[model samples]
Target: MLLGSDVRRMLPPPAMGRFGDLLAATTSDTSGLADDMSGDRDANAKLIEAFRQGVEQPI
Candidate 1:
């Protein structure tokens, strides 16, 4: 997932614009998905720290 994110980040502006258009066309509603994934910010930070310490998997 991180690698995919990195690849998407590397897309050129025109490619990114097309990607966004495709996504918007396919997805009817993203707000609910966004809300579902919007976890605790502090917990996320702690999890990231734990991953960095090798105590947790990146996934």
Candidate 2:
């Protein structure tokens, strides 16, 4: 979901760099862990709407 990308994007530069290093050491493809949010817009929109609905509901 967009939350994962959003959280990664929020990471400090130093931490993000470290994460990239770790990914490089363990995985052949680290593109998914990149600090980019250029993911599926439609999926992100649906997630946002679901989140909003959850927030508006009572506990």
Candidate 3:
């Protein structure tokens, strides 16, 4: 019972509006190919590398 309540509380907030807005923004920027995580493996690799560098050397 305690574990069940903790699991439920760990879930993200029910913000449909905010999620929709974010989805719209991502799709708009990704050119409708946002669902293809493995379709553009090279692009994905570059993106991950860029993200890693950005995190390691912020600004």
Candidate 4:
């Protein structure tokens, strides 16, 4: 998902406060989820699952 990484790149400034924090979907490493968007169907599934799990976590 280049789109997903692009969206993260577009997160608002922290001047936006908690909403900014909520929208900032970055991993610890700046490389991002797009790096994982390779390989077969199973790989994509794994990434989607990981993203789902991350989304379910508290901001």
Candidate 5:
């Protein structure tokens, strides 16, 4: 996600290492890092509420 903003949230952590050894062979950056991830509670809540509203729009 660019600048901690994404259309979707991150996937499950344990579900990432599908390739096992193959994945370990490569240097990856998407390690669910705290610094890269957003910790802004207010902004996150707003985004979540917006998503909920968008979903409810069709209903």
Candidate 6:
């Protein structure tokens, strides 16, 4: 996720008008998603799902 964010940040200036609008929309969507979350519930759910999937195997 951090890598994805970094790549988005590194994208060069938008070329066409539509491309600029797309970039703006994507940024707004990301900001909205982050702001829509309330507390640790979202974080906890993510962690739980990760563990359930065995992606982050128990230590």
Reference-based lDDT, residue 27, model 1: 34
lDDT per residue as tens, model 2, 1-59? 35445545666778866865554453333443322346785564555445434433333
Q: Write one digit per residue (lDDT tens) for candidate 5, span 31-59.
A: 32323438875565555445434422322
lDDT per residue as tens, model 6, 1-59 = 44333443455545333544554454453445434557675684454344333321222
Better of 3 and 5 by lDDT: 3
RMSD of each: 10.5, 12.1, 13.8, 10.6, 11.7, 11.8
Model 6 TM-score (2 dp): 0.27
Query: Candidate 3 residues 1-59, lDDT tens each?
Result: 34323433444556534543454455454544434676676676556444333333312
lDDT of 3 at 2: 42
Order the candidates by lDDT, highest first. 2, 4, 1, 3, 6, 5
User: TM-score winner among the candidates?
Assistant: 1
Query: Which is the winner by lDDT between candidate 4 and candidate 6?
Result: 4
- Residue 53 of model 1 has an lDDT of 34
Off by over 4 Å in 6: 1-39, 55-59
Order by TM-score, highest first: 1, 2, 4, 5, 3, 6
The lDDT of model 4 is: 0.48
The 10-residue segment of model 3 with minimum total lDDT is: 50-59
lDDT comparison, 3 vs 6, better candidate: 3
TM-score to native of every candidate shown: 0.37, 0.36, 0.34, 0.34, 0.34, 0.27
Collision pairs in model 3? none
State which candidate, 5 or 6, has the greater TM-score: 5
Candidate 1 minimal-lDDT segment of 10 residues: 50-59
lDDT of 2 at 6: 54
- Residue pair clashes in candidate 5: none
